[model samples]
Target: MIQLHDKQFVPFISAKEINFAIEKMVSQIEDDFFDETPIFIGVLNGSFMVVSDFLKLYKKPCEVSFIKLASYEGTESTESVKQLIGLNQDLTGRTVIVLEDIIDTGNTLEELKKLFKSQNVKHFKIATLFFKPDAFKKDLKIDYVGIRIPNKFIVGFGLDYDGLGRNLPEVYQLKEE
Candidate 1:
């Protein structure tokens, strides 16, 4: 069990389980991108662990970059995304993959898609480690998803609560009060 803010204690998604999920996600990506050397764009902070593990399993040649976006305060969704750090690479005519730790409202992903389009990227794909189907508010297709989880505040594997617990090896849910 792990302890979180508000004196919450809950079991986390085990590291072994996370590894299994990553393996599956990587296999799917490899099959779809077998012929192309695509550019992988990892959403910062929360996605760092997932992206790192995924890249290690990626057999093909590819480049990696990061873009930072923020939209959460504590366990609540703000429904707004702010790009804290911008992409520095030129994405024109490039096959790009956007990696996210979790997808809830879809606002962040939608905004990213528009941004990439404006930069003239030829193709864009999404790969998220976690997805909340019930909380999804926009109609955007996700190319790859690791797991479908209920709407909850999660921490670990780079996901955090108030800048804590991000380094936990597995994912954890906040305990109810």
Candidate 2:
């Protein structure tokens, strides 16, 4: 078990498992986007690790950018996403993929849809390393999903609790009291 601040967590997903999941997701993306280059827009903060690893595994030619959004406070989603960093690229008629570390409440995805709808992009796909179907409240279709987990608060592997545990190589779930 590990403690970050006042919360304790137990190991949930190992590094090897995480990498395997990512590879599968990447393979699926490669199949769909082999003919043309796709621009990957990574959600900042939590998606840093996911983006780095994803790029390393993906050999095809592609471009990457980042957009920072905030919707979580501690372990809970505020259900309101605020875009802190905006995209400056011309995404008109381009294939854009939004890389996210996790999709729980789908608040951030909602914000992304609103941001890209007016950009005239050919199409946009959502790729997330982790997903919580039970917690997802939005009706959006996630194109690529690495893993589908239960509705439990977790940290590590780019997910954090109070801005901690992002550096951990594996994932951990909140320990029950």
Candidate 3:
């Protein structure tokens, strides 16, 4: 168990499970883009650990970049997204793959889609390590997902609670009061 802020959370997904999921996704990506060079765009902070592990197994010729966006305060979404760190790559003719920690309302991904549109990106896909299908309201297909978890607040392996619990090897969900 772990405590973040004033709540207690128990182990939800173990590290081994995380690695397995990543490996599973890597195989799919290799098969899909084995002959192309795709740029892996990681949404910062939350995707740090996920992107790290993913690249270790991504042997195909690819590049990586990061952009930071925020729409949450602690465990709740403020329902507004803002770019903290803007993207600085010339993605004019590249296949881009967005690596995200999780997707809830999809506001962030929508905003990024707009950004990519403005850039004239050749093609792009979204990937999230964790997905909350029940909570996702936007009509966008998250191209790849590590796990489809219930609409529960989770923290660990790059997800955080007010800047804590991100370093935990296993993901944990809040304990019921």
Candidate 4:
């Protein structure tokens, strides 16, 4: 177990499980994208690890980029997404996939989809390592999902708490104080 913040004790998701999930997700994406060379837009900070591992398993040709968005304060979702960093790639008419570490409220992904549409992206899909279906609030669709987790405060595998613990090798859930 690992300690998050001051009083939380969280267990790690373990490397073995992470690897297996990535393999499955990659297969799904390969089948969906087919011949199109999709551009993967990774949501920064939280998605760094997932994107890195996912890219390695992708058999098709593709490009990778990043955009940063913030919505969490401590362990709770803010329900508002703030675009801390903007996309630099020209997505016009390109097939794009937004890779995210976790999907909770769906606010961030929804906002990104709208932005991509306005930029005239021909196609877009969402790929997330973890999803909290119970907490989801928007109508957005997740094309590829690695795991469905309970609505709990989680960190690690690139997810962080107050900008720390992102480099941990596996996912972890925060322990109640």
Candidate 5:
């Protein structure tokens, strides 16, 4: 159990579950791109933990880059995408896999996809540790998803509320009010 910004939360997903998911995702990624060297574009801050664990488990040659986008204010997403940091890579004729911590509304992912398309990337795919199918409103296709969770305000494992609780090893869901 943990508390963030006056909201109490209970354990939602354990670290063991996260590790198992990571292993499965890594195996699939390795098999899918064994013949090609792809560029992994990590969605920064939130995806730092997942990206690190994934790369460690994925024994293949790949390039890595990071892009930071912010859409959250406190526990709620503002739904207005803002680019706090941009991708510095050329992104020309490269196979890019966007790694994200979670996909909720899909607005940020959609915006990123559009931007990457304009940059002339040869290919693009989205990989997320968690996906909220009920909460997603966009019609975009997520290439890979570790787990599906309900629309709950969660924290830990690189997900945060008010910029806290990201260091926790497992995930927790906010308690009902």
Candidate 6:
């Protein structure tokens, strides 16, 4: 168990498990885009760690970029997304893959569609390290998923609780009071 500020969390996903999931996801990506050079667009802050690990395992040639979006405050989602950083790369006729740390309510995913709707990319896919199917509200398809988890608040491995436990190598689910 661990404490971050006033909340206590228990060990959830291990670091080794996280690495294994990432490797598996990379293999799937290689199968689909082995010949084509796809550009990876990581959702920033949370996706930094996932993107780093994914790129290391993916041997195929690819480009990388980031778009920072925010939709949470403390342990709850604000139910809205705000794009803090915009994509500057030209995505015309290029295959683009978005890497996300986690997908819950899919509010961020909706915002992403709007942002890229005008980019005119040849193909676009979404890849996330963690997914909460029970909580997903959007009709959009998530192309790649590393792990399917319950709709519970979690921290660690890039997911954070008020920006505190993001640096932890393993994941921790919020403990009941």
Candidate-wise lDDT, in order: 0.88, 0.94, 0.89, 0.87, 0.89, 0.94
Q: What is the lDDT of candidate 4?
A: 0.87
Q: After TM-score superposition, what is the CA distance of residue 102 in candidate 2 from its true location, in Å? A: 0.4
Candidate 3's C-alpha lDDT? 0.89
- Prediction RMSDs, each to the true structure: 1.1, 0.7, 0.9, 1.3, 0.9, 0.6
Encode model 6's per-residue lDDT on 83-103: one tens digit a residue.
899999899999999999999
Number of backbone collisions per candidate:
0, 0, 0, 0, 0, 0
Q: Candidate 2: what lDDT?
A: 0.94
Off by over 4 Å in 5: none
Model 3 regions more than 4 Å off: none
Instruction: In angstroms, give how far residue 110 of model 1 lies from its true place.
Output: 1.6
Q: Could you tell me the C-alpha RMSD of candidate 6 in Å?
A: 0.6
Q: Give the range where candidate 1 is weakest over 10 consecutive residues by summed lDDT.
A: 3-12
Per residue, candidate 4 scores C-alpha lDDT tens digits across 74-163 of: 878888889999987788889988999999999888888877877888788898999999999888788889989998878888988888
- How many pairs of residues in model 4 come into backbone collision? 0
| Candidate 3 TM-score, C-alpha based | 0.97
TM-score, one value per model = 0.96, 0.98, 0.97, 0.94, 0.97, 0.98
Put down candidate 5 lDDT per residue, 72-171, tens digits, no spaces. 8788879899988898879788889999999999988988887787888777888999999999999889999999999988899999888899999999
Query: How big is the positional error of residue 156 in model 4, measured in Å on the Cα after superposition?
Result: 0.6
What does candidate 3's lDDT look like per residue over 81-124, in tens digits? 98999988788889999999889878888888887887777778
